[model samples]
Target: MEPCERARLHAYFSKIASQFAPAEPAASFLVTHLLAERPAFVRAVAAMSRLRAVLPKPKSVNAAAQREVEQAIPCDTLSRELFTDPDTALNYLESRAPGESIVLLDVGGYFTPTISELHSRFSGQILGVIEDTENGHRRYADVDKLPCPVVSVARSPLKDPEDFLVGQSVVFSTEAVMRDRGDILHGRPALVIGFGKLGSSIARLLHAKGVQVTVYDIDPVRRTQALSQGFVVARDREATLAGAGLVLCATGSLSLRGEDFPHLRNGAYVATVTSSEDELELDGLPDVYTRTAASEHVTRYQTTGHYFYLANGGNAVNFLHGASVGPFIFLVQAEILAAIRMLTRAGLAPGMHEVSANDRAAIAATWLSYFNR
Candidate 1:
């Protein structure tokens, strides 16, 4: 993935700021996002609506980001704590006026309070919620119905390119990890669980990197798709792990566990790009394996018979180890702006909703025009 040109970023987001107008205007919004660290992002969002408060996630914030938030967003409008800290996030939301029409802007609702607590505290003030990641979409899975519309970029068609770019980032970072550990990536067998959009890109990247890659997906159609792409498709999880020197999970599902550790090859390394630790269960293995901190983001585990590793403690390794995908993030920001605008006016029947085809086209056009310039 290429570094985004700063000039293009400013011009593109400035155009976004000029064109963005929510049909049913919100009184205010409490945005919980990793992008809050970017001054351009703060400025663009401020142009869209009355951004009441911002809860920046820990992983996305650094010294520079903290300075940017302080300098760009109003002190009264920014939460001091990491939004992932649930108690602090709940407290901040609780202090707000119940009657204030607020939209929950987030990547995965990490900063937002629980759905039940949100309704209890804010009542009908929650105009809607917009989420941008697969894990965030899964958070609402158990709800029989939602109080307001949910505009999810993760569930929408918008994630197609984003996940592909992420796959490229993954291979870049994974190669670094492999090199650090003295693992010969080329000619080594690898297992990729889940043949979804993210997994497919990963499989393609791995193949390009000269790894013998096998895919496992429960969805029969996805499995067939992988097979059609000329990659080996595993019968199941066990079949996938067998003799695999590297394993990566892109499935949002909680599929891997410590019990399955025995199935892995002696020197296999495991990593994940999903938002949850569920993709690679760390419960029992965390205690049993002798750990080695390879870096701030990479950790290695050694057992008597095998060596295993967990990237970013089983969190999304892309953000943890590699360069930030600024261009792709800008596209999602555009999608988010459009989603918030649509949700304010549209009466979506709860659950998860897609960005309208018109909105998608407009976003694409905006990005293409900017890129072409």
Candidate 2:
């Protein structure tokens, strides 16, 4: 090649490689590349590296973190493999099925990986998948790409036909377990209020277990949508209170209080999977059963003609029940284990959802593994 042409080729190749730097580093290099004519100014570019650290990381980090913990970053890594892959988890869920075909309801931002696991392990036995957000829908099973039954939808549509989807669908759960607020109803007619994505999943999970379900959502649109999906919509607060099994209050918001508790059924086993105080007002109500977060989030009150129980006093419902951690890896590992047991009938040897006493140590171990520390 000619000398001038060779120099131009070298410059072009150099420019292409510089394009791959991190955000701030890329910007400074771009500036330097342009200022190469002024040699002195180009050499001063090292000063800009500090500015890159100050700028915020992309919001994609937030989404990834949400995918990790199910909520925000308030919790620690309970299981690392959940964020990594679905083998261990798929193995666990498969163990639970006992040769029976299994169904799973995944409600969150990251569900594609789980569906893939199900498709691989269960093969023909795998059912469908649903999620809340539009991104989740796109990221979920690609019906065209995969050779299994996966929904190419963000929300389960009311169009076509509303059919009853069944099987043992483990939900995108939280960290909370109902230790207090006794009178647990293992099975009966249950009133589950709030029909957003999470509530719908919980209602479906119960329905699969053969429980009579009455659904309520403040939004008429959700009620209409849920009804078309075969849910028996509860109209009156009084009628909602007349039920006989359990009452679960779940709105997307985790900051719920006693004000959000649904009117109960006669002997209802109430516990919220959303936030604990979604039942604050019903606390101490005769048949009202709930998780233990009420201790941190509830306040008692007596009203005219009847006693009004606030749903949440202070504590969060998910904190008391199973936390909404199933979507991401930290919680993902536990969910996969459940799925493996459910689908493959495999068992976890031990330390499935174990938590360490020291927070720093746990975080360090997770960080080291996540970043190869």
Best candidate, TM-score: 1
* lDDT tens digits, residue span 1-373, model 2: 3576445434432332242222322111101011112121112222212111111111112333334332211222222244236775555444444343443333332335555555566533543332323333444433345423332222323210111111111121111222244423355676766776557877777776577778888789999988998889987766666554556665533322444334443323344532232224435344443333333433333333333223333333333232223112222222222222222222322111122224224333442343241
lDDT per model vs. reference: 0.70, 0.37
Instruction: Write model 1 residue lDDT over 159-195, tens digit each, in one string.
Output: 6777888888877777777777676678679898888
Per-model TM against the reference: 0.86, 0.35
Models, CA RMSD each? 3.8, 22.2
Model 2 bad stretches (over 4 Å): 1-22, 25-187, 253-269, 276-316, 321-373
Displacement of the residue 50 alpha carbon in candidate 2, Å: 9.7
Name the top lDDT candidate. 1
- Candidate 1: pairs in clash: none
